[model samples]
Target: MTSVKDFRVEEEPTATDLGRGRFVFSDRYSVFDWGEMPDHIPNKGASLCLMGAYNFELLDVNHVPTHYVGVVEDGEVKDLGECESPPTEMAIELTQVPDLPHEDGEYDYGAYHEVAGENYLIPLEIVFRNTVPVGSSLRKRGEPADYGLDTEEWPEEAVDLPEPVVEFSTKYEEQDRYLDRDEADDIAGVVDLDQLEELALAVNHILTDHAARAGFAHEDGKIECLYHDGTVKVADVVGTFDENRFSYDGQQVSKEVVRQYYKRVQPEWVDAVAAAKQEAIETGEPNWREQCEIEPKHLPDEIVDALSDLYCAGTNAYVDYDWFDAPSIEDAVAAARDLN
Candidate 1:
């Protein structure tokens, strides 16, 4: 096994050598490097593992190339004796993208670039939005920063243009940047003008189609692509609320689930979040999580339960498993748009 620094072993689902491959994932989730904050969105790790595998299978069905090897079959899962949890519901095999070296001992983006070669982590983000949901950074900013709708942080009153706004996200900076077309193409070199639009269109179309069938509207979404062996196929989960914006019955229902929990279960943190946002403005680039001196925030039982339920609901809604009568893709999109 390659011994890498900071490569803490997770016992829950150990990644045995199994020849040239392994099944591994992190318990870590970062919104802004608020590292290991003692908050666990119960089932979040499993949901991601399961949902990511599910999407990988779907993409395979769609003839999209991906990095998934296969999930652990019924007999492959084992307990590491650390704790008792459901038998992982499901386990998956994933291609190991070696951790990159960080500039400040951070995750090394450059190493990621080098190791990935031409099939590098395209330092580009494909963002799609369906509606201006409440509590959205855009909504919360209250017009001060426009999300580059017309220009970088355009005025609050700027009406959205004719097209779903597109921006180039920088891969290097401490903060991701939203750049204009020229900046995206000429400067970024991550993608060309026509190609970016085409890629974005394909991603949005597929996710919207999927979301629509689940009785939701496919407002917008994003894709992160790598060149990978000379072809571009979907590289990440396509339609999850974490990756895209979606609504239920004309209501903003995605991240709101988690946000509401914070608001209700940890109302005190709301002021902290707001203050962090303000600090972010002054710093030009903000990492609110780092500013939290109140380390390892506790998640209440109610909050955990709410988040778990939300994850389950979101996953079910996205998959349309007949667990619920989600509409077909077309019907969902139409219904979602009817809200406007």
Candidate 2:
């Protein structure tokens, strides 16, 4: 099981073949790579599943290759429209995810690729940004000029990019870190890094336009892909609030809301997590959590309810479907702001 979802492999993929599986998304949420949180946001699982299915279908219409098969409802895989109610399970084509060999305080991707062969989940995440929002890592990684902003420093608010910026980060590392193009290309093995970037940009364009139509700003998102038969197909979920950052009327309408809430309410735990990560880097320790003494506190019930409404409302707005009887996105965001 992943941090927020339980996965079942009906057929396991071989080194050169595809398999079958389903992801049962739970109401569980995670922040700061802390595995699972103490509370579950009501309806969050169904919201993400429906939103992911919607985006996958939209991508299919745009001729984007993906591992999505359909949503699972009543023990059967069905198209999003065919599902009578909101779904929590998603059927997907499986790709081999061989354990990345780690030794001497370094990950051996060459060994991983040799075992992964042609059919595998790419060990890199492709991120695309349409806007450099406050607290964005891009601000620390690049200069304003690097992103085409004609300013000496980054603005206090979000800045729209002249063009979508694509980036790569390690997926299987103890602590995911950004990688340069050359390193990313080397890690990608036989998969073309340029093609991956192109695919990520296409996804960003599609999601950005979709969010605009729905009156939301899609700031950024990342996607993982599976390489099979010399083809790259987007794997896992896409365009969901959990996977992307969205804002409505200058307010966060995505999981960032919850993360920010934690930052405000549990600052010590957040700081400890960061410090532990740095300590791990210096100490060559793989498990950073072991070094952190602080543990996260549970979110207030009111905050959880507001976030639940936000997820459902955002999904309803993005997909143009009323899957949940929740408040409007505006109302949801307002409620979240009040709680925070």
Candidate 3:
């Protein structure tokens, strides 16, 4: 399947028409919709595989359906035997992909809905939030009070919510836009809006509990689902540092660490990107990247190293295993904090 991360898929001709393939994870990471940046974080692929498998196993035991079959090491399909860390590849069941065409700057979701009969990836991202963090998109697009916070303005620091909030956003579009329940229902023709919310919240419950046990705060996360044979299954990697926002004692222990570093180092480019997005919303045009003439500079070596350590260290702590020889999570967090 195509993804921002380097998760490759290769079909086996010998297998039945029911698709079977290997998901090859890589050290590559993406940020700000920029796919496959120039650097590779050491052991990042292994860390993600380990964490994704961990969550998949948990969901399976809890009776949540998923596409995960097994992990692949040395070309052998095996159980996630000992969760020290995973190899580069994992086996999974593949599904049909919807054809979403765009012509003359307009997306033809109607055609996609018509073609996507019953088994395909859902064209919506169900996002759930437990807190209003410093760089939350909610702060930019909505008022603090919209989420039941008592303040007229969001604080500079993060603010915790009394309860979790669930929302939907367009997934396959060039520029993802927030959607109301009705809008989400219209795009996701096959799946009911209520059922979508139910599955998303169920996942949130499991992950939030897991994060609590790991001593990390699960601030928020998004999960993707697949509609297969009249059933919706959680289809993608979940509960990784990249997929979810986790914090250790108020310091970010997830990819937000990298995002914070970039915002500090590339303030002008970040501001330009934000302006371009706002302009796109105001003008109802989806080609905002063309208007944004700024190119992001490669992250400095020091920042990259710091982020690499953050990923490895955080993964170790979350999985309760020293899979990599890295600094303690506290030390890594301190180093990332010192970057400013």
Indicate which candidate wins on TM-score: 2
Compared with the true structure, model 1 gives a TM-score of 0.62
Q: What is the lDDT of residue 131 in candidate 2?
A: 89
lDDT of 2 by residue, 1-340 (tens): 9888999999989877799999999999988888898999999999999999999999999999999999998899999999899999999999998888888889999999888888989999999998888888899998999988899999998899998999999999999999999999999989999999999999999999999999999999999999998899999999998899988888888878878888888899999999999999988899999999988998888888899999999999999989999999889888978866
Model 2 ranges with Cα > 4 A deviation: none
Query: Residue 334 in candidate 3 has what lDDT?
Result: 88
Query: How accurate locally is residue 244 in candidate 1, as Cα lDDT from 0 to 100?
Result: 58
- Whole-model Cα lDDT per candidate? 0.49, 0.92, 0.80
For candidate 3, give the lDDT: 0.80
- Residues 1-340 of candidate 3: C-alpha lDDT, one tens digit per residue: 3433444557632112336777777877877765566677777888788788878888888888888988887667777764334566778877666678877667787888777677677888999999987767788888978888899988999899987899999888878888878888988787888888888888888989988898889999998887776788888788888889898877887777766767888888778888987897777677787888887787777878888888888888887878778899899888878886
The lDDT, on a scale of 0 to 1, for candidate 2 is 0.92
lDDT of 1 at 113: 45
Off by over 4 Å in 3: 1-4, 10-18, 82-85, 140-145, 278-291
Considering lDDT, where higher is better, how would the candidates rank from best to worst? 2, 3, 1
Q: What's the CA error at residue 140 for candidate 2, in Å? A: 1.6
TM for candidate 2 is: 0.98
